[model samples]
Target: MTDPALSELTPEQAQMAARVRRMMLIAGLTTGLGIAAVFVAIGYRLFRSEGSAPAADVTATLPRGARIVSTGIAGDRLLVTLEVGGATEIRAFDARSLKPAGRLRFAAEP
Candidate 1:
């Protein structure tokens, strides 16, 4: 209480110092909160995805040069029809094992 000279400052200087301190505190808090929010969001996504991907049951393979026209699935089977050099090839596949089960086709006439 007795250090009067050090405590004394011009009114304008005192006001400016108060404003600068407040600005610094507000800026620091804004930066800190922004960084904390980003970390929280990233952590949430990381923790939540552990159980998300489903196990798929089957796949299909076609000869490389075939151009697939359409594909569909019925019950446990996959039906695919494709064309190559003006010939249409159709095949059904077992959905679980992905092996060819049957074939049906109608070729384009020359």
Candidate 2:
């Protein structure tokens, strides 16, 4: 006995099914490509280096009688404000390598 519901599809129905399958395949490929791109971006960020080795240990020496008033980070530099001999000094160092970048001193006029 042949079941009507399980019978072969009409020509129009078969064409419609094929068109739907094609659309679904395109959508699936697009979604898969997007997910692959995301994974690639994440992998690049995780594995790539920033062209400089990170410092394992850093030691910055301060002058005698120099007291650290404040410390902060500005852009890519680390800033340290110090009070030395009644004068204020601002020192900037490279945040990555801990190298001295520049210095600023504030003094009263004579």
Best by TM-score: 2
**TM-scores of all candidate predictions against the true structure:** 0.46, 0.63
- In angstroms, the error of model 1 at 53 is 5.6
Question: Candidate 2: where is the Cα deviation over 4 Å?
Answer: 1-8, 50-58, 85-87, 106-110
In model 2, the Cα lDDT at residue 80 comes to 99
Per-residue lDDT for 1-110 in model 2, tens only?
99998798999999999999999999999999999999999999878957767555888899999999999999999999999999999999988888999999999999
lDDT of 1 by residue, 1-110 (tens): 57989889899999999999999999999999999999999999999765633556665666778899999998989889898666888899877667789998787667
- Best lDDT among the predictions, by candidate number: 2
Clashing pairs in 2: none
The lDDT for every candidate, in the order shown, is 0.84, 0.94
Candidate 1: where are CA atoms >4 Å away?
1-3, 51-110
Clashing pairs in 1: none
